[model samples]
Target: MSHSIAIIGASGYTGAELIRLLATHPSFEIKALAANSKAGQPLANVFPHLRHLDLPDLVTWEKIDYSQIDLCFCALPHKTSQEVISKLPKSVKIVDLSADFRLRDPAEYEKWYGNAHSAVEMQSEAVYGLTEFYRDEISQARLVAGTGCNAATGQYALRPLVAAGVIDLDEIILDLQCGVSGAGRSLKENLLHAELSEGTNAYAVGSTHRHLGEFDQEFSAIAGRDVKIQFTPHLGPFNRGILATAYVRGDSDAVLAALQSAYEDEPFVEVLPKGETPSTHHVRGSNYCHIGVVQDRLPGRVIVVAALDNLTKGSSGQALQNANLMLGAPETAGLTLAPCFP
Candidate 1:
């Protein structure tokens, strides 16, 4: 009953995370690892922490024998993912960890990513990869699209309230703090330790963050109306988590009730007691998302907070979760590890 798997873009943060989680999976066997740039190198050479486990050496995606792979996780960047996924074999189920397939409207994808989608037809076939809300669809889909980390964090805090009509849709605002790893394994001047260690600053301000497109698409659909939330993201000095605080005009009790009801049965999402806020540290290195609700001193105003590992629940873990459902395995099969907390 073990599912054969392949991982493309296997040298990136999300790619490495998928390997780390799958290493202990009871029903998944890694059959191939693809990293075009590191094609001939052993995975251990690229990620030393994973040296303990024996895994396939990195190869290019074209070199993989997809006929043997039951599921393939594409951790490539946006435009690249579309181009590559379009060329992949149709028989293998795919879980894309890029922004490429998340937006169904090609125009919206072009608007946010500034490039025309290469695979327009496949766009119609991609099921959004927010595991909790899209579980039923994911289980039946051949292609699943992983959500943006920031978008996932915010949605875990707001989607329930939006659906329950317990909050003012037009007045919602989400301010998030994300760790450096969310930027990926790529090198950048700003990510240097000397430059980022002690400070935190907001980037993608004024609702300019690309994840807003996701918020708009998902929230609007839930309400059957346009719902735009002002979102601002900040890059923190840390290396692994995301914490988002949502400000909304609503009855505090109702907001808590909505969130509790929405995730009461979800294995990976936990709703904390009212007045208790979550922290990024609590869910680091795990597939769990923790959410909390707090009442504002002024009545009818509430603050909802959510935290999760940007690389785990936000991307690879989510992809694997969808893959499990698509393959008929227990949804929590390879994802039950506890969060890494110091």
Candidate 2:
């Protein structure tokens, strides 16, 4: 049976990405499209490339009755998702592609986002939506919170090693570079065509990036203790990918074996052959994440790298993966599209 689905913030990058992937999805029916500011307009008017699909016109949340919807994709921004999700029908399962529910502790959420969570009750009920790491929880959850794009990339490289105790928990360092789309569709002077076209620069330096909360949460959970990693993110000229390099203290063989063994059966995450390295170009525009592990020249150290399309595997794709699990459908349904290449 086809499940009815809605895209709550349908005018942004991840929202449009959800539409693109769901358009060809076999068991998911796009039933509702909502965007507060763009209400009453046709979805295609805002996203011309999606003119071929049949989707509801942009409507205000108050205009649609949630009774017919089986699942919702909350793609709104931080803080906004919490408020909007709090008002939705209780029975509808949600895969929020926002920071609203990713952090489990309300205090942590406030610490990183600078606002008290308005939906603590629901926040307590959400499952982190890193499909590879939280499959069991997501399969049984009514609300699955997606990870930050950079966070997802970083975790894919280091989580397995951390879980296996193959890497030194205290020595983790991540250097990540992300494409422009991860910034969202908002207009900003720094993101203009002229400014970003030929330059590459870093931001959120010295552990100032917010996704560190995710690394702190997941890494600490796996180690059963406090774990912190130095993280820095850089903006690149490309439009859609993330490449993260994690410098860890561990045997290269053990790190490789751990990642290969952990993701051995998972469909979306793959540990590449030895000596190989991940690149954003390789996994661009797909739900797939490619990870590579190698030994550094210095003994007792390993260099782990992972690549993925931030908008897909990092956000909407992960959301759909969780939705499939929640709806009791095949875990990989509507998500088999391979990475785009030249």
Candidate 3:
């Protein structure tokens, strides 16, 4: 029998993406959708693009019957996710797409998120949902914490190198370009078309981005010490995708080899041929992460560029991938759609 699922916070981008993917899934059924802000409205009215699918109408979370849901995708905002997830039935598996439970250390979560973690106990149990790296943990986890999109893209480019001791950990720099949609569906003066269309500029410079916490936690765990990378995320004019160029101290070939060995069996992460760079277009609208490696002219320097659809491989797609593992579904089920390229 197909697993019945409920999507909390179903009107946002990640929530909508989850619905789009699960709409055709063979073994997953969408039974409930909760979007408090747009409750009682047809999902089609909130997102006309999804009009074709037969989906449940949006309702407030209080009205959903959680006992009937075999799995839940919690796509609520950060603080809100922890609050909502804390109340979910233990029998219901969850893949949280917010930053709430991604950090294991409650203090660390407060340090970056500026609020105390309300669900400290649950936070301790969440497996970091980087499907390729935490496959075993996610398979047995009831709550899987999805990584930040920018963080996921950066890790795909450098995790193997960090784990293999092939690169100097102290000198890592990740220059990222992300589409405006990463800001979510919220209204912002900067996100207005008039302000965002004409040019591209970097935000979260000086290592101020919140995803840095994820980098610190994951890379440190792999390296057996604290690892900090220089990360600067730029908002691009496009609608989706994240391209991260990582500058590190290492032999380009060695770094590439490490990445290749790490993801050889991974179905979603693809390492391009050496010296060939990846473009956002190649991974747009799909749960694929493409990495390319190149040697910089400067001795002992290497550049690794990784690209993925921020909403797909970075968030909802990642959530679903983990959910599949938690529920004994094929890890790649409902996730094999080819990228949409122009």
Candidate 4:
């Protein structure tokens, strides 16, 4: 039997990516779509790239009967998602693609998000949806909070090293580059064609990016101590993908060996052979994460690079992966699409 699913923020890029992936899923059915601003429009109209499929017309959340939805993907913005999800039926499983529930401590959330959490109770129940790290928890979770795209990419590079004690926790630094689409489909002066094309600039520098919260939370838990990493994100002119380069104090062979062993069994996350750096173009439009490890000239340091489609593996693809676990479907179903090439 196909599980009935609803997408609450259908007009956004992540929401549309979900529809693209789930369109061929064997046991999942798209029963409803909600995008208040585009409520009366057809999904095809909102996202022409997905016009080839037969899908439901968009509607306001209030117009849908929640009793019929078995699962829901909440892709709304930060504050709006928590407010909307708090009112959802208790039985509906959720995979949230927002920064709302990723941080467990309300104080920490407020510190980073600059707003008091409106759904503290529901926040406590949301499993951190990093997939590989929390598979068991996600399979049983009523709500799963997706990680930030940059956080996800950086963790793919450093989490295993931190856990295996192969890297020095205190000296970690992540310099990441993200495509403009990660900013969302919303209009911004900087994202304009004449402005964004053929140019790149760094933003959220000096520990200001919110994804640092997720890194601190997950890495600290893995290392059994407080682990803070310096993270800086840059905006590239491309439309999708994230590439994170991490500098760590560690032996090259040990870091490579540890990362290889950690992802040896993971179907989606791949650890490339040593000295082979991965490019974002290779994983674009796919749910795959490619990681590369290399030694730095400095004796005790190594550089780790990780890449993935910010919208796919970083967000929507991950959301679908968690949903597959929650719904008891094959973990790889609807996610076998290969990466696009030039």
Residue 336, candidate 3: how far off, in angstroms? Answer: 0.6
Instruction: Please provide, for model 2 over 5-82, each residue's C-alpha lDDT reduced to its tens digit, 9 standing for 90 to 100.
Output: 988999999999999989888899999899999999999899999998878899987777789999999999999999
lDDT of 1 by residue, 165-278 (tens): 999988998899999999999889999999999999999888567898999999999999998889989999999999999999999999999998999899999999889999
Candidate 4, residue 9: how far the Cα is off, in Å: 0.4
Weakest ten-residue segment in model 4 by summed lDDT: 42-51
Candidate 4: deviation at residue 327, Å?
A: 0.6
Residue 156 error, candidate 4, Å: 0.5
Q: 298, model 3: CA deviation in Å?
A: 1.1
RMSD (CA, Å), each prediction: 0.7, 0.9, 0.7, 0.8
> Which portions of model 1 miss their true places by more than 4 Å?
none
lDDT for each residue of candidate 3 in 131-187, tens digit (9 for 90 to 100): 999999999999999999999999999999999999999999999999998999999
Candidate achieving higher TM-score, 1 or 2: 1
After superposing candidate 4, which stretches have Cα over 4 Å from the reference? none
Return the lDDT, model 3, position 122: 93
93: Cα error in model 3, Å: 0.8
Worst 10 residues of 2 by lDDT: 56-65
lDDT of each: 0.94, 0.90, 0.94, 0.94
